[model samples]
Target chain A: MQLALGPLLYCWPREQVLSFYEQAAGWPVEIVYLGEVVCSKRRVLSLDEWLDLAKHLESAGKQVVLSTLTLLEAGSELGALRRLCRNGHFDVEANDMAAVNILAAAGVEFIGGPTLNIYNPRTLAVLVGQGLRRWVLPFELSHPAASELINAAPASCTCEVFAWGRLPLSWSARCYTARAENRAKDQCEIICRNDPDGRLVSTREGQPFLTINGVQMQSALTQDLAPWIPEMEAAGIQVLRLSPQYSGMDEVVECFDRLRRDPGDQEVLRRLQSLAAVGVCDGYWHGEAGFANTANGLQQS
Target chain B: MQRMKLVCPAGNLPSLRAAVDGGADAVYLGFRDATNARHFAGLNFSRDSIQQGVQYAHGHGCKVFVAINTYPQPQGWTQWQRAVDEAADLGADALILADTGLLDYATRRWPDVARHLSVQASATNPEALSFYHRLFDIRRAVLPRVLSLRQVARLIEHSPVPVEVFGFGSLCVMAEGRCLLSSYVTGRSPNTYGACSPASHVRWEETDQGLESRLNEVLIDRYGPGEQAGYPTICKGRFRVGEHVYYAMEEPTSLNTLDILPELMRAGVAAIKVEGRQRSPAYVAQVTAVMRAAIDACLADPQAYKPHAAWQQALASVSEGTQTTLGAYHRPWL
Candidate 1:
């Protein structure tokens, strides 16, 4: 399976974002989705800078796609979506229907972003009719469902699953990350950049649970399907997306590279355990609750 | 001016029946499955109940809108699609939709069915509204709570479809259709699973620090004996930013737009929506009845009608408690 690097969900300094992409140039991933998928207030990297980086990544042999804001609030966000549709240099990942309509009206072939919520073969066919080239499975869809959908994708569509990283479960217009810092969204001061892996939320019992990433909420556990490589391949998944985290992504990519090289390697899970953050879950893949980890050889009770 | 329709939520058959009987002009509900946004257990309608509900609402001269609003997963589109087909077959007046693919499917599969855009679509502008209207032939759009009155006015001016505004319910401080906070913590999203701050992920503890509310093993809120605790979500929880610990995302507020009824009506809004789908049947009946009377009184005489103190008190009793904001309708920045 090919590796696809997802758009950076967390807000980062412009320098940090540039440096992250700079390092990603040499990573084994084949596709890199650039642009903000969360809040639009963040001006870490302007559209021009993102396009410039897209060129660099493309030159380094990676296919690039510009992602639209998951939540389009005002006229300005719609204008940005229009610009992304007109960018011309790379494919667009339509996160919302407005983006899809923008792309379809312009006759731009786009990847159906995970947030598009494609649930069955018929919806896939509908999007494909509307010019869908590739589609990412929503975070909550199980592996069996994904397998069925992948097998059912139209001839022209590529099926990619968010195989690794903390699943981005939702996006909102309200800035939770800023709220976590006791600030209004307008005066958030880009405080979300401080928590690179997202601010971890713990239960009263000190159980690691969720993470706050600005307007987006994610799982505290980095979901990994490294051990499920055999099943994914068997299921006909073309690409496995690994979302960028705050740190240790290079090591994470390297670990995935090794697994791709030897899909049958029994010790991949043991090696991955040392590298992944706190918890590992592939429950959504197994058609169970998302937190259930099928990799540990233990079925969820 | 004609009285705007008061569309209220009915999580289950009892709430559905209560909302219709409680004087709602129309009651909107979803099936027990994932097709609707309120997918909490013991909530939402079953197939037989939905059919019965349509008949009951029609008998009462009330309309029924089935919310097949959740985003359909690629592998699970069958349930959502079938729900829409069944809703159409059952003679439901409308279907509240969010996903583009599903919207396209509903429009193509059931051209005769009326389509109301769910808040989950987050279509806040004229262009977005027009796009949905042109593509899906959507008759109405539920304005996201993030819009101010001016924005809503502008939208109504340019929108090809009629606008529906949230008059009351749980105020999603964050934009609806876009928030993933609940899914991040509980592994269930309102967009994907029709659940927000699901109960399975929530737990409260009384400790030396006071009452702590937790989700997915994370301490999202800590309440002193007197301080009211909001629902648990990473953003809604009290956290330290530099030196301040407060409700960062939202301070647990319910939207009470009763006072602003005149403003929304003046803005040419076509309908007023109330937001509780997971609340009790009694809560639905009380809120709907109060709002129905409040709207009627306002339309009959805006100059003499004061925001009912009793309505406010009853709403407060069922609300999240401690905090209430007009939400984005009055906000300069939402």
Candidate 2:
């Protein structure tokens, strides 16, 4: 299976974003998803800058898709979606129906992003009628469920699973990051950039529960589904998506790339566990609580 | 301007009858199975009750809408299809659906039957509303509980289909259709199992900290003795962010738009929905009656509409946390 670099979900400096992709062009991944998928206030790089990055990635033999925001509330955000639809070159990953509507109207074959909520083959077929070429399995699907949907999917469509990073579990219009700092979404400064990975939220007993990264609520534990690489390959999975975190992402991608080739690399999974700042989990793949890791006989801690 | 329709919930036959008698223009309910959200035991309607509920509602000039809104899993696709077909055969007024495939089936099988997009569809913008309207010929769309009042007004003006906004009920801080926080903690979710924080996994224990509610051993909240406790919804739980411990996602509050009835009327909203299908018959009656009176008062004189003191008091008695906010509507952001 080929590895695809998912979008940079966090807000970083423009220079860091540019340089990350410049370095990412040399990574072992074949496909790269660019642009922000979480908040609209973050525009470190404009559409042209994203296109420029796309061109840069393409020149380095990477297929690029511009990912749109999962939630769109304002007309300005809609305008940006319209611009992404007419970007003229790179395909769009339609995060919401608003993006899908615009992309379908533009008559472009686009990838259905994880947030589209395609669970069954019929939903997949409905989108395929509107030119859906590839679809990302939503983060909540279990391994068996994912297999069922993937088996029934049209052969022309490439199925990609979110194989790494903190799983985004919830989203809201009121920014939890701003709220954590006692700030309003309209007047507060962009303090969400402070937590490069994401601000951790734990239960009152101090057990990790979730991560507040701007509007999106992610799992405090990073999900490492690399242990399922061989099974996914046998299940006809063509692509594995690795969401870019703030640190150790290159090595994470390399590990997934190398592990796909050599399934017996027991040390690779251990190294990946060391790389995750908040630990690892594959409970969603096991059809259990998403925060617990039971795969590969790992402890729940 | 025409008075907006007030839609309310009905968990069982008593609630269905209560909503009709309490002056609901429409009462939406779900099947007994997992095909709908609120799949709690002793809640929802059976096929026989659906028939009776529709007759009772139609007899009272109140519409009956059967909700088959949960995303149909691959294994249970036929169950959702059966729900739609049963709702159609039972002579319901509309089918509230969220899954695209179910909508496709309903569109093909019952083209003449009215289709209303469930809030679980999370169609916040006009483009999405148009997508449902064009694709499924949906008669109306329920807006997710995330848009500000101004955003709602602008969207209603441009939407191809009529718009419905929540009037009063439990608040969802996050988008309804996309959130997986419940399934993250419990194996069941609104999208898949039609239940958020399913009670089968909930456990309330007396601990040293206090009376604590846990979902599958995950701490939800701790309350002092005799203090009011909320349902174990993960979103409203107290959690620590950095140095502070509080309701990091949302407080245990209900969304009440009683203060903004006139503004909603001015916005030309087609309907006002109350957001509890798991509540009791008394709750359905009280909320439906208060909302009916409020809508009538607003329509009688938009310039001089006010939520009555008794109305607010009665609502607060049955509210989630004895607190209410014009959530997302008034932009209670700061």
Candidate 3:
């Protein structure tokens, strides 16, 4: 199975984003998803800049796919989606159905992001008919469910699973980050840049429960599926998607790369656990609570 | 302007009858399983009950809609398929579906039956709405509670199909189908299990600190003395972010669009949906009655339309937190 870098879901400085891609060009991953899948207001990297980065990554032997936003409420966001669909040079990962509609109508083959909510074989078949080439499995799917969907998928459609990173739990119109800072979504300055990894939201009992990205709520636990590589491979998962984090992404990619080459490496799993910024969880894979760390046999803290 | 249809929720046979008798133009319900979003214990309709409910609604000159909205697992796709077939056989007016797979199945098998895109589909844009309409031949699409009035107006102007907006309901702070907060905490979610923050996993503990509401052992919120504690939906819970503790997403409040009844009607909204399927028959009757009156008043005199004070009081009495907001309809909320 090949490792694919999922879209960057957090806001970062333009320089940091550029340098991260520059460094990622040489990483062990074969495919890189470049674009903002979170808040559309995060315009640190414009479409032209994203296209430029996509070109640079292509030159470095990495297949780049531009991702559309998960939620679209404004015409400006739809306009951006139109541009992304018609970029012409690179494949677009359609996160919402708006992107799917635009790309399918344009007769462009696109990758289906996890948020598209494809579960049954018929949905997969329909999208495949609409020119879907690859589909990222929704994060909440259990191992057996993912395997079933992948096995039932059309022959031409590849299946990718979210293998690493904090699970993006939900998206909202209200920017939780801005709300936390006591500002309206429109009037608030782009304050999400202050949190490269997203701000942690802890329970009243002081246990980390979720992470507040601009408009998205993510799990506090970083999901590590490295321990289940063999199961994923056996299930015919073609690609493993590792979402970009603030730091140590290269090391994370390297660990996954090594595990892809050699599936039975316990040391690599340990290294991945150490590289995680939060506690590791594999519960959703086991049909358990998403925050539960089934690999470690521990309840969610 | 068309008289806005008042769609009411029916969790059971009684609720379905109540909605139909309480002046609902239409009543939407679900089967007693995970095929629909309100799969709670002692809630939802049995196969026989759905038939009876449909008959009652049809007898009362009201339409009946069956919501088969949850994303079906690959192995359990047949259950959802059976639901569509049953809804059609029961002579339901429409089938509210979210999964594209089920939409495909329903349209292919029962082409004559009307299909309305459930809000759980999260098709917030005209492009998405047009795509579903073109592909599945959906008659109408429910707008997610995340769009502002201006956005709704634009979408209505551009949409290829008719649009329905939520009028009164408990607010989901996040997009409906995409939220995994329930699954993250309790392993069952609205998308998969058709329930959010399932009561089986919830615990209310009285402690020295306060009355703590926990969902699957995670403290959602702690209420102080005399503080009105709402149900522990993870989104409305207070959480500590950095040095501050507050409702990071939103406070526990219901959505009441009574004041904007005229605006919505002027924007060409076809229907107003009241969203409490798990509520009691009384709750369904009250909400459906208020919304029915409000829509009629707004459509009767669009220029001089004003919300009734009694309607607000009736809705607030049944609201989760005894308060209401326009939710995403107001730009400031976003």
Per-prediction DockQ comes to 0.32, 0.77, 0.86
Give the poorly placed runs of model 1, Cα more than 4 Å off. Answer: A264-272, A297-301, B1-3, B11-18, B32-34, B40-52, B71-82, B99-102, B126-128, B174-193, B196-249, B297-306, B330-334
Across residues B291-323, which tens digit of lDDT does each residue of candidate 3 receive? 888888877897888888999999999998888
Of 1 and 3, the candidate ahead on lDDT is 3
lDDT of 1 by residue, A109-188 (tens): 99989877776776777778778999998777777778778888876788888977887865666666765655677788
Docking class of 3: high
Alpha-carbon shift of residue B148 in model 2 (angstroms)? 0.1
Please give, for residues B1-334, the per-residue lDDT of candidate 2 as tens digits.
4569999999999998989999999999999989998899989988899989998999999999989999987889988899999999999899999998899899999999999999999888988887788789999999998999999999988899888899999999888899999998887889999999998999999988799999999999999878889998999999888889889988899988899999998999999999888999999989988999999998889899988999999999999999999888877552
lDDT of 3 by residue, A1-301 (tens): 9889999989999999999999999998999999999998889888999999999999999999999999999888999999989999899999999999999999999999999999888999999989999999888889889888888887788999999999999988899888888889998699999999999999988998899999899999899999889999989899999999998999999999999888777777888888888788888889999998877832211
Q: Candidate 2 docking: what grade?
A: medium
Misplaced by over 4 Å in model 3 are A297-301
Ranking by lDDT: 3, 2, 1
Tens digits of lDDT, candidate 1, B288-320: 989999999878887787887888888888887
What level of docking quality does candidate 1 show? acceptable
lDDT of 2 by residue, A1-301 (tens): 8899999988887788888898999999999999988989988888888898899899999999999988888878888889988898898999998888888888899999988889887898899988899999877888787888888888898899889999999888889989998888886578888888889998989898789899999999989888888888887789999989888989998899889999758788788878887788888888888887876464322
Please, what is the TM-score per model?
0.88, 0.98, 0.98
Cα lDDT over the full model 3? 0.91
Off by over 4 Å in 2: A296-301
